[model samples]
Target chain A: MARVIRTIGWTLIVLGVVVLLYVVYLLWFTGFETQREQRDLADEWSLTVPDDPIDHDREVDREAPEEDDEPVDVGDAYAALWFERDGEPIVSDDVIYVVEGVDLPTLRRGPGHYPESDRPGGEGNFAIAGHRTTYGAPFWSLDVLEPGDTIHVIDRQGREWVYAYVEQRIVQPTELWVVGEDPLGSGAPMITLTTCHPRYSDAQRLIAWGELLDDPIESTAEGGERDEIPES
Target chain B: MADNDAPNGDDPGPRADPDGGGRGGIPRWVKAILLLVVIAVAVVVLFTTVFPWVEERTQDPTMGTMLTPWLAYLRF
Candidate 1:
């Protein structure tokens, strides 16, 4: 009887240890995979996006999609997402490439854009989903983001859309309204970032909302040859 | 019966263990610890290697995929 009890106890201990190791993998090892994917995606983005300097005098119709705003294939990287704090880059040289789909596999590579949502700087909500605790954990500090913080997105044509943080909401996972076309109900150009809430749990979602600012810097394409354009 | 010849008494010397001396005459507690260590190593391999290989095939990035039906609830 004593031996049987000891065996049972050891079995439980082994199970506990397994759970701990999985948590470790989720928190640490998974980031390596995401970082590698992001590096490749970043390289592709740099090569594809024009290097032309910001054309300050160019006119941009915020409500209309540009001719170059071709739909990005799902799982493919097309734009670079950057966070700014105090007018400086937040993640320090890390430019997270935003993939075209919010599916699990695409998100594992980096932040994913919701297919039904509007494009960056478009007249509706441009929603994105990202991981908070695994697979690069790009939104790991999302909950701490305060209003007025800025998020910048650079597209293939070198158009930079700047968005200012507005509010945050913790909602049930079933709350699909957060990603709706007019989440703010004003038909304004906005951004919504969704991630698992409360760290280490997916019971709910944490949403960070932002509105597109008017100062969009446009970089012109020079002869469609990236090599000919000088990098600033 | 042979019981009368051997005499039933508390003789703590080396005796035949029907459960098999696979225990190698080691103490029960020591064996239990060794068993736990082996299990821990297996668990590490399963998480660090086996599960990853399975994930690669399934293209399922979440760990919940391994647990399946039971862990389907763990998905976002």
Candidate 2:
């Protein structure tokens, strides 16, 4: 009886160790191969076969004009809102814009700060954080954004990427599930905008979800692109 | 006639019972095998279904920014 018990115990221990090692491998290595492949693809696509590259900085400095009614470009039209101690625009070249009417504070982040684990120029969700009621009330109207509203994000290239509103919900603060990668399942990409609820209380979080509705419009392509653009 | 006076005291009763057979307990080896099978199934399910779903949800922003290029890549 003692011999039988000892053999069984030893076998179980070995099996458990093997199972654990396999799980670790899946989480840390093999599971991440897809992302690496995607990154490689991106790098390959970004390679430019220069047609007629010129000094962009020198050209801009030479062409500066005074008393212009319209923006110099579409990129300039999408401005980042910065707060002041006494109500003034905080001007900086690094600031990025949030979706119009997203209740600014919820999406507000410090200039040039991006999360390390996330992709810098991805299409699915580009979430920014800001205060709900205070700090200039950026996201005050966040709860009021209905379906079909357009949220625009302008990248450094002066291209505008538009995302259309889909849904919104209020959930408990501890429900980290909302922030998790698999809110629904794989292949269903979405954006989740979140803020503290009830204006000033941290009781709950309000989330507004949206989906990319159109491809990004490069600054040079806007004039001709409008005709081919679909209603998103 | 003499042997039938009383039954032998050493005779055993039925070996198997509906609720409590003496040998019905699962051996430790069987239990270990079962545990291994359950764990393997769980890991397979998580990797194939659960993990991908979670990755999609949490990586949305990253995915969204890259979606255009990714879609174009797929076309080729």
Cα lDDT for residue A75, candidate 2: 13
**Clashing residue pairs, backbone N/CA/C < 3 A, model 1:** none
What are the per-residue Cα lDDT tens digits for candidate 1 across B1-76? 2111235665534544444333257654566678868787878788778766544333322211234444536443
The DockQ score of candidate 1 comes to 0.12
What TM-score does the predicted chain A of each candidate obtain versus native chain A?
0.79, 0.43
| Model 2 lDDT, residue A112, Cα | 17
Best by lDDT: 1
Shares of reference contacts reproduced by the candidates, in order, are: 0.09, 0.00
Point to the candidate with the largest DockQ.
1
- Predicted complexes: DockQ each: 0.12, 0.03
Task: Give me the displacement of residue A125 in model 1, in angstroms.
Answer: 1.2
lDDT of each: 0.68, 0.39
